[model samples]
Target: MRRESETCTYWSELIAYLYGELSADERSEFERHLLACAICREELSGFERTRAFVRTWKARAEEAAVGLPAISLGSAPNQPQWRQALAALREFFALSPAWLRVTSAVATLVVCALAALAVAHAELRVSSEGVAFRTGIFKRPPAQTKAASSEPLYTQEEMERIVAERIAAARAQMLDRIQSEQLATREQAQSMPHPSPAQASAQQPDFEHRVRRSEQAAVALARDDDAPRLSDLLSEISD
Candidate 1:
């Protein structure tokens, strides 16, 4: 009983394992569990025996159906094909587990119900008006149409104004988004490590070199008669 309780969780897997339906990892795991589980071992043994018995029974039934001498009354025919099929079907269900039998019964009932509905010319419709079901030999006319909503529709100018307002709102949203992104980027930049003095100096253009270039440009400009001298400009600015 303890073993049965322990095996309750694994019972479904046991069937799959027996039928080689489990994947590689699952098969390995179950096999390892089986080695330690006496309940599972015993269950597997019983299942094997039952399967063998069923196979033997099935073979015998088939042989009997084919090879057995049909004792018949004068002019009476052998068993019908349907009887054989029914027998086979019965055997199949008999061999199946309870769940399969219940499922088959449920499926059969559903099929029969659907077939009955089809034969009855059933029709179902759902609309704003309401749900409707019809069943008859002849087709029924469509239901009355629902009344349109009382709300007024927008005119062309109203639609254009609405579109313009939407565009403005969208543009404002884009601008706000851009501003937020710029702030975030600036904050991120500030959060990062500051450059070392040497690194900073290396990155900056040479101030003395820039001054020399400016002086050279000023001299060139001074040589041009049309341009004012740097000295004169400085004196003028000082004055």
Candidate 2:
């Protein structure tokens, strides 16, 4: 009965013994038991066989890892040409310098921004009033006080000068508006109360306590009432 119990106990540790994981005294005791026990010796042999099989599998995995280039060369049949090309392109991009990637991203964003601005600035309308040309960024197209005539009244140079003047004036107005808004924001920020050092130190723990209290309150409310969940309230608001 004792030998049966020991066998049962040490059955789980057979692999550990086979792999030399047992301490020196434990291993010595197990070895002495092995000499007397046929069942333990058979179990140890089975564990040794399993270990040898795992080592063989590991050696094959290492060989496969080392032979990946050859495998890829021979197995081009599995993947489509476009998929392979895309994978190659992805690998190339992955290896690109950080600065190059950043510059590419910035250039793409700038192009998109410029394109959006150009679309916004362009105005094309065909109505009973007649077609008009309006492409200025900030200023409205000049109104025609005089009736439209086939003959050109203003020379190209005069038109260019007028457009330039309008652009300059519009730019100045925009700059003034921006500066005023910035000044107002700065003044408002300055007027706002700032916490003292003592208040600042106390605020962190107070803020955390308030958050915990709010969470507890919410949980209590949820448990007390069969009211709609917070998610449902949010979804209703969104709708």
Candidate 3:
């Protein structure tokens, strides 16, 4: 189990190295390891054999395709020329493992994308400024001069005038609010029923009498702290 796990670790590395997928430093490092590791060396040899077998299979497939006699389209109505070519291509790769096939497909796609980009004159740049990607007959419009702002600029005097106007408007709004509150209060008061002159005169004596009695009780309580209680005031008032 331990040996198997250790070999498995180098499995991907071996494949990458075989496919020329590793960078210079990684490839150098892997080559040094490969020389010392018996398991990796053995696995690498096995892979090389498999790769050679696949290549031979592909060559034979191509030869078989070439050796085939050209037949009229009507003679083989079910198998089209394009279908035959596709079948030949499939047969060519069929000997290779699934991983190898997938890797080849992906590598081919990447190569095609890069080729398209090169043909299109695609440019990609990264710097402190920012990442920029541009393609095809693109001239970066001469770094536009900071466009003069379209907004109207105010002079110091104009700015002061605007601030003064804003302050005046705020004051006006506050005055309007105060006026509305006062008007609402006045309207509310006017809506309420008012006592007549006779009613006012009648309540006035009782109100004044109550005030005089409260003042006298307060004075007595101040003069005698012992009589501070309301019950004492009530007794005095009763008397």
Clashing pairs in 2: none
Error of 3 at 108 (Å): 27
177: Cα error in model 2, Å: 79
lDDT score, residue 135, model 1? Answer: 85
Q: Which candidate is the best by TM-score?
A: 1
lDDT of each: 0.66, 0.61, 0.65
Q: Residue 104 in candidate 1 has what lDDT?
A: 96
Return the lDDT, model 2, position 239. 60
After superposition, the stretches of candidate 2 with alpha carbons farther than 4 Å from their true spots are: 1-9, 68-239
Worst 10-residue stretch by lDDT in candidate 1? 70-79
- How far in Å is the alpha carbon of 233 misplaced in model 1? 99
Judged by lDDT, which candidate is best? 1
lDDT of 2 at 236: 62
Give the distance in Å from residue 140's predicted Cα in candidate 2 to where it truly belongs: 55
**Any idea what lDDT model 2 has?**
0.61
Candidate 3 residues lying further than 4 Å off, grouped into runs, are: 1-8, 68-239
Candidate 3 local Cα displacement, residue 111, angstroms: 33
- Compose the digit string of candidate 3's lDDT tens values, residues 110-149: 9999999999899999999999999986655677688889
After aligning candidate 2 to the native by TM-score, how far in Å is the CA of 31 from where it should be? 0.3
